[model samples]
Target: MNHLKFLLAIWKANLQSVMEYRVSFLTQVVGMMLNNFIYFAIWIVFFDRFKDVRGWGINDMYVTFGVLASAFGLVSLLFGNAFTLGDIINNGRLDYYLSLPRPVLLHAVSSRMISSGMGDFTYGFLSYAVSGPFTWDGLLRFVLAILLAAVVFAAFLILVNSLAFWMGIVSSFANLMLNAMITFGIYPITLFDNYAKLILFTVIPAALMGAVPAEYIRSASWQILAQLLLGAAILLGLAVTVFRSGLKRYESGSAIQVEV
Candidate 1:
């Protein structure tokens, strides 16, 4: 309970800080919305020419994109530091976190915010609103799915970035893996074979982060929701366990720092 309060205070501070820069915040938010719309346009064009592939249709594409964007945006909005966690760990910035009495991972990851994420988060519901499957039940399912997918994404980021505890400055490798998930996530999983699908579900977790959540929103299947819940729980537990274990081996950067 106290931890929750602490997190709320941190988030409130972050929100206030961003809100202070109103024009810049709005510009970033609007720019991100436009970017997502333009990227989603590729699917609009593809479906225009090829129509549905297998069982997937344009509406399905919209749902998938919405869930993906929402999950990504939420992570970026609240846990923006996840993207830079590897660099932070590599550069000895964990020292700042270590000296604090809070939970290190949570504090470190929640300390930053990306204003553009608001746009993506807002546009997600706009996509869903137009997808024609909005129901009281589906809306509830969509919200649940968004939370689960965001958990998986946050876990995946931790899983990869925690490697920086051992390997110094792995930003390039981390970026490649992140790009793979984002690139593959926006597409219909039906386009992939069993092997690739396996990779998506396990190694990169793109399917869990995007496809499963979208499917849950579309069908409201209890089994799909259960799978997402179980996947998220397992991955989060694993990620936290790994990070805690790695912290024992964490050493400060050998590079010297001089104060200005």
Candidate 2:
């Protein structure tokens, strides 16, 4: 309970700091919305010509985008530092976190919030409102899907960023991996073949990012939901294990400075 309160306090501080610069905050939010809009527009154009690709229609696309956007937004808003973990590790910023009396990984990931994530959250709800059925079950399913997707996304980020301990300065590579996951997640998994699908579910987990959740929502199948839950659990476990193992290899750069 104390840790929860501490996390809330940190989030409140971050929100207040961002709110101090209202224009910059609004610009970042709107800019991300517009950036996401471009991708939706492309999908719209594609669907106009080819009705459905492997049974994935506009509605599937909506669910996919909704899940992915909300998941990404939640992760960024709550754990923005995860996205920059590689840079933080490489730059010796972990020293401050290590000195703090808290779970280092949790503190590090929750210390920052991304202002632009607001737009993604908004976009996700809007997409779901348009594409999903207006029912209690539907809403519950959407929420579940978003939760699972967020876990998968965060796990992937941590798993990739932990490489910094071994490789050092892997910011570019980590970012590329994250971008690739997002890029592949927005599309239909059916578009990929057998081996590609295997990799998507296991190594990258692009399927969990959007595909599996979208399918589960569309079909409401217990099997699909089970797969999503299992996948999320496995990925999360792997991420935590990898990060803790890597922590043993971390060598403090002794970059601490006293502020007089």
Candidate 3:
């Protein structure tokens, strides 16, 4: 509970920091949404030319894109530091977090806010909205799906970023992993064979972040939701364990500074 409060406080601080530049923040958000929309236009062209790929249609892309973008947005917004953690670890900046009274991982990952994430988050709903045939229940289900997807994706980010602890500098690999998740995530799951599907569900876990959650959003299958829950728990547990283990070997930069 106390940790939750501390997390909230960090979020509040970051929000306030961005609030000081509301115009710029709004621009960043809107710009990202436009970027996302334009990027999806390529799929628009593909689907227009081909109609459908496998069992997935244009609407399926919309829904999947919505969940995947929102999941990415949540991480980018609330846990923005996840994207930069590799650099932090490599640069010895983690000393600041290590010296803090809060849980180091939580503190390290939640301390920044990427304003563009708000754009992604808002655009996700817009994408879902246009997908049509809406309901209160479906909206609620969408929320649940994105939350679970975000958990799985964030865990993956932390796990990859934590590699910096041993690799010295690995932000490129971390970015590649994240890009793979996004790249593989936006496509239809049926396009892959069983072996490739297994890799998506485990190695990259893009299926958990995209395919599974998107499936749940489109179908509301209890079975799919169960998969989401189990995957989230497992990935989160693994990421936390790996991060803690990495902490044991952390070599502080020892650049002393005071914190109030």
RMSD of 2: 1.8
Query: What does the lDDT come to for candidate 2?
Result: 0.89
Best-fitting candidate, scored by lDDT: 3
Give the top-scoring candidate (TM-score): 3
Candidate 3: segments with Cα more than 4 A from true spot: 256-260
lDDT of 1 by residue, 1-260 (tens): 98899989988999999999999999999999999999889989999999998989999998989998988999999998898899988888888888779999999999999999899888888888888945898888888888999999999998899999888788999999999989888889999999999999899999998889999888778899899999999999999998898899998855554311
| Candidate 1 C-alpha error for residue 102, in Å | 0.6
Ranking by lDDT: 3, 1, 2
- Between prediction 2 and prediction 3, the one with superior lDDT is 3
TM-score of each: 0.96, 0.95, 0.97
In candidate 1, position 7 carries an lDDT of: 87
RMSD (CA, Å), candidate 3 to true, equals: 1.4
Which pairs, if any, clash in model 1?
none
What are the lDDT figures for the candidates, one per model?
0.89, 0.89, 0.91
Taking the candidates one at a time, how many backbone clashes does each contain?
Answer: 0, 0, 0
Give the alpha carbon lDDT tens digit for every residue of 1-260 in model 3: 99988988889999999889999999999999999999999989999999998878999999999999998999999999999889888878888887767789999899899999999998898988888798999999999999999999899999999988888889789989989999999989989999999999898999998888888988889998998999999999999999999989999668664432
Looking at candidate 1, the ten consecutive residues that score lowest on lDDT are 251-260
- Higher-scoring candidate on TM-score, 1 or 3: 3
Query: What lDDT does model 1 reach?
Result: 0.89
lDDT winner between candidates 1 and 3: 3
